[model samples]
Target: MKRTLVIGDIHGGFKALQQVFERANVTENDQLIFLGDYVDGWSESSQIIQFLIELSEKQECIFIKGNHDAFAEDWFSSRETPGVWLYNGGKKTVESYADYSPENLKLHLEFFQRMKNYYVDEENRLFIHAGYSSMHGPEREVYSSNYRWDRTLWETAVAMDKKLSRNSNLYPKRLLLYKEIFIGHTPTLHLGVKIPIMKANIWNLDTGAAFTGALSIMDVNTKEFWQSDPLPSLYPAERGRNK
Candidate 1:
């Protein structure tokens, strides 16, 4: 049986990662793909990155870049003020590597930079960090920003109820670009609130894990999904209003 496991935003949730594996009963034969945001929010950013790297070495693991991951990369790239890194979950990631030297940080940044924006299986099932819009372009020409910050672009695509053609730059006809696409970023529904988009055609496995939501995953071939209970809180309870 051909099996592929898609993991949602990790956000340094190592326990959640373990739970998902236990729930899915993942084995060596399974292919694992992470939707990004492996660091940030909770503790263990460095540990999680290293863990994921090791897993990648052993199996076919695909990594997508998320906004937080981008921030981490930017911090390492020396693109902005030193404090910028601390503001965007970089503190936790840095602490995770407290024992390492500057050289280690450089190496991790390199690894993050090489992570692909998306992955497409032979079946045409697209795995991306976030959704794309009609303004996107050819697979090779697709921009990383779309995967990192494209909720508005995808919202536009959803609003128009049409796939933006390749030539159309505002939004790339994402749906038309592939048979099916799996993405992270937006939380389909809050944890324990009876999500509105449960079991929809376009799978959203985020499950709001960064907030009170649980981490989720789905088997693309069978559409069999699994989620873990919410992990302990990292920040005080706060509600994020969605427009």
Candidate 2:
């Protein structure tokens, strides 16, 4: 089995993302899957997009779209309401493209729209931005809405389904089912974990890295995890400078 590593929301924290990858020690054979929210919240959106594009060209990397990414796509593409993206932490994304004109903005928006909603491997390990519930259907039948919202439903389903599977091993073949699902979006602290960490058989890796928490990554097979130190407090003077 190939060792896969799924990362949480990056939110323009490129340096932190790099540190997590380094700690994971990704190999050429190991595929890295990102849970999205790649831009916004921080000031390095441009650099982070460039890096992700480069990595995608060389390695087996899959990108999933998060709600923040949806905002970015709309903002750059000029297809959304004017104030929505700007209100949703998109100020940094707009600033990231300061050097670009209208044409470049159009191109960037196209790139964001190209991102996938979710990824399901041969092992049925579902990688999505948020999560789906039983209403979305069984693990194999998840809907795109699950990827953008509906975590509470998914959590309830997982608890019930995993419990039943633990006892009966029925409903579907085990190999075709996911041993786990990886997601990001909602901050894990809100999920009751004292600290930012993976939880609920669904790895809640977001860690609020773009806000008060640190960025994080976890190994899919071994459960090993890595994170950057909490982001340093920035003075007003240093807020928008690219690292």
TM-score against native, each model: 0.79, 0.79
Report, for every candidate in turn, its global Cα lDDT versus the true structure.
0.69, 0.69
- TM-score for candidate 1, residues paired by index: 0.79
Q: Over the stretch 1-243, how does candidate 1's per-residue lDDT look in tens digits?
A: 547988888777777787888998887788888888887766767878877777877877788888788888876777453565566556666667678678877778888988888787898777788766543432644565777767753344345534544455653344556676677787765334423233213566677766667788788777787877774543334221111
- Per-prediction backbone clash count: 11, 0
What are the candidates' C-alpha RMSDs?
Answer: 4.9, 4.5
Candidate 2: tens digits of C-alpha lDDT, residues 1-243: 567888888887777787877877877777888899998777778788878877877888888888888877766656454565665667877777788767766666766877998787887677888766543334454465666765663355344554454435454332224667777887775655524354335567777776766778777778778887654443133342123
Error of 2 at 172 (Å): 14
Model 1, residue 54: C-alpha shift (Å):
0.9
* Candidate 2 residue 157 C-alpha distance from true site, Å: 6.7
Q: How many backbone clashes does candidate 1 have?
A: 11
**Model 1 alpha-carbon drift over 4 Å, by segment:** 79-85, 135-143, 153-173, 190-201, 233-243
